[model samples]
Target chain A: MKADLVKTLQKKKKQILEIWMEKQLADAGLRDDLISNEELRIQSEELVQALVQSITEKNLGNVESSEFEPVYEILAGISLSRAKQGFSPRETGIYIFSLKDSLLQVIQEEMRDDPAAMYAETIRISKLVDSFGIATFETFIKGREEVIYRQTNEITEISTPVIRVWDGILALPIIGTLDSSRTQVVMENLLQEIVETGSSIAILDISGVPAVDSLVAQHLIKTVSATRLMGAECIISGIRPEIAQTVVHLGIDLSNITTKASLASALRHAFSQLHLEVRKKQKQQ
Target chain B: MEKIPILRMGHFLLVTIQVDLYDRLAVNLEADLVQMVNKTGARGVLIDISAVSIVDSFMGRIIGNIANMSKILDAETVVVGMQPAVAITLVELGLPLQGVFTALNVERGMELLRNRIDLDLNPEDDDDDAISDAD
Candidate 1:
C-alpha cells in the first residue's frame, strides 16, 4: 500500500513541483527580497527530490527515523539559509506548508478511485509533512540565534577602547551599562594601558553611560582601587547631574574617588598631577 | 625553619617574596616583619612581590597586616613590583589593600618613600621660610 503511494509520488513529481512553485509564488508571505523566484524554485526542487528518495515502506509513517535523514538535511539547509537571508519565520513556515498542500492535491488526484485508501494516505502524508515543517522551523530559529550571538561578541569587542590622550594620561570612556563581566574587561584594558604607557594618571569618562546605580558605583570603585594598586590615580569624570543625584540618593560613597564633572576638567586635573601646562601660542599674522 | 630575610637599606627595610606563600608562612612573615621593623627603627618598609604569583584572601590580609603594623611603628609601608595577575586576583578576592601605598617597582618605591620622608621632615623648615631671607 505504501509502495503504491511512493510510486504515485515519484510518477507525479513534476506536477507536484509545478504546483508547489505556484502555491509559493501566490502566497502573501512570499519574500522575493530575501530569495529570488528562480532560487526558490531550485531549493523547492532539491527538497522534493530528497524527500522522494528517502521515503521508504517501513518508515513512511516515522519522520524521525534515520531513513529520513537525507530529507531532513535538505530541509534544514533550506531553512537555515532562509534565516540567514533574513526571511521571516512565517515566510519559512508557509514555504513548507505550501509543499504539503501541493503533495495532498497530487495524492487526492492519484487515489481518486479508492476513497478509503485516499483518506488513510492523506492522513499519513499530513503527519509526515507536519513533522518536516516543525524540523524546518527549529533549524531556522537555530540559525537566527547564531547570527545574534556573533553580533553580541562583535559589540563587546569594539565598544571598549583605551585611548592615550596625552603622555602619562589614558582615557577610557564607557558607553554602556556596567556589568561585572564588562567591568572586568574595562579594568584589564585600563591597567594594561597604564603599564604600557607608564601613565601616572587615568581619566574614566562615564559620559556615554545611560544610568548609574549602586552596582555601577561599586564597579567604578573597584576600577579606581585597581588603578591605585598599579600606582596610577584614576579620576572619574562625566558625572551627569542625574547620575550624581542617583549616586547621592543611593548613598554610595564615592568620596574617596577623585571625580570631576566633565572630561575637560579631568584632563586639567591629570595635567596638574603631571606638573604640565597647556598654553596657547601667541597669535601671528 | 625557613625564614624570608628582610634586608635593611638605609632607613628602609626591603623584603622580596620569592616563593608562593602558604597561610602559616604568611603569618610568620607578618610577625617577623613587624619584629624587624621594631628592631631596626626603619623609617620605611618596601615589599617586592613581583616573584609571588598567587594571592588568596589570607595572603592579602597578611600583606594588609604588615602595612598596618609598620604604620603604627612610625614606618611607612610601600608595596612594590606587584604582578598584574596578582593585583587582579587580590582585587577579585575583595581585598583592596586599603591605605597601603603601591609603586611599579623597587626604584620607584624608594623614590616614593624618600619623597614622603622628605615631606614629613621638612614641615618645620618649610615654616622657617625664605632661608632667613638671606642671599
Candidate 2:
C-alpha cells in the first residue's frame, strides 16, 4: 500500500517525490511526513484545482449545471470563496456574477418567445447559483427583479414598490432566508440605491424569513455595515423569536440597530422619524 | 395545469402545477390561484412550475399576490421550480414575493412548509374560514 501510494505520488510530482524520499529516510512514520511536506501540499492543491478546472472548462457547455455538483463545492471551497469572496468596498461593484454559466446561457438563449419556461428556470437556478459571483449574483437578482421593472413600462426609477425611501430609509422586506451571496447582492443593491436615492433608513423586515443560521446572521451584519458607510440606516423588522435566538446564539450584537416586529411597525417608525403621517389612501394597503 | 399531489400528508398540501408557460396563465392565474388555495383548504401550499419556459413581470406579481393572500389567510405559500431565465426575469421585473417563502425545488418547498406550519390534528383556528376574496 505504501509503495503504491508513493508510486501514485511520483506520477504527480517527481520533485515532491524526491523530497518525500529524504523525509521517509529520516522519519519513522511515512504517512504523516509525506502529507505534512510543503512541496507535496502545494502540489496536491494545484492538482486538485487543475482537475476541477479541466472538468469545468471541458464540460461547461455540454453538461447541465447539476452535473457540476462536485465542481460547485470545490469552487465554493477553493479559489472562489477563499480569495475572491473578500469583505471591503474594493470587492463590491456594479456587475452580475454567475459561475454556473451553463444555466445562465440556457436562460439567455431561450428568453425571446419561450419566456414563460425561461422565467421558471431562472427561479430554479436562482436558488442554485452561488450568490457571491458578481455576474451570477447580478443575473440571479436582476432575473427576479426584471419582472417587477417590466410590469409597468411607465414606472419611474423611484416608483418601484421596493426601493430606498427619503430620509435615508430603505424599506426592503426580505422574503427568504439569506445566503452569503444573496446577502452581497442585497448589500450592493441597497448601497447603490441609497447613493442614488439619498435615503437614510434601510428597514429590512425578515418576518418572512423561516430560518436563521450563523452565516445568515453574519450576512445581515455585513449588510448593516455596508449601509452605514453610505450614510444610511438599516432597520431590521419581522425578526421572529426563533431568528432572534439564532442571532444571539451566534453572538451577533444587533442592539444598536433599530428593529421592529413587523413591516407595519417599522414603517410607522420611519414615518414618525420623518415626522410625516398619511391621510388614508396612500397608507391603506 | 397538471396538479401533482407532492405533499398530501396531514396539513401539508404540496402540488406541482406544470405550467409549460406560466406566462400563458399569468393574466388570471393570481386571482385564480388565490381561489384555488382557498378551495383546497391546505394550511401549506407549494406551486411547482419546473416545466415553465418563462416568467414575466405579471407572473411575478401573481406570485407575490399568492404569498400575501396566503399569509392573510394564515396559510404559507412557497414558489418552487423556477428556471434560470425565470430568475433573471423576476429580478429584472423586481416583482418576486417580498415576504414569500420560495424554494429551489418541490421537495425543499415541502420541507419549508413542514417547518413553518406545525402539522397537528388539533385545528385550533378556523383557518379555512379566513380566506377572504373581499376587495
**Per-residue lDDT of A28-85 in model 2, one digit per residue for the tens?**
4334522445643453355334433443323433334565555444433433332233
Q: All candidates' TM-scores?
A: 0.91, 0.29
Candidate 1 error regions (>4 Å): A25-36, A84-86, A282-285, B122-135
Give each model's whole-structure lDDT: 0.88, 0.55
Candidate 2, residue A179: CA error in Å?
A: 21
Native RMSD of candidate 1 (Å)? 3.7
Per-residue lDDT value at A132 in model 2 = 31
State which candidate has the highest lDDT. Answer: 1
Q: Per-residue lDDT for A82-131 in model 1, tens only?
A: 87798777777878888889999998888788889888888988999999
Tell me model 1's lDDT, rounded to 2 decimals.
Answer: 0.88
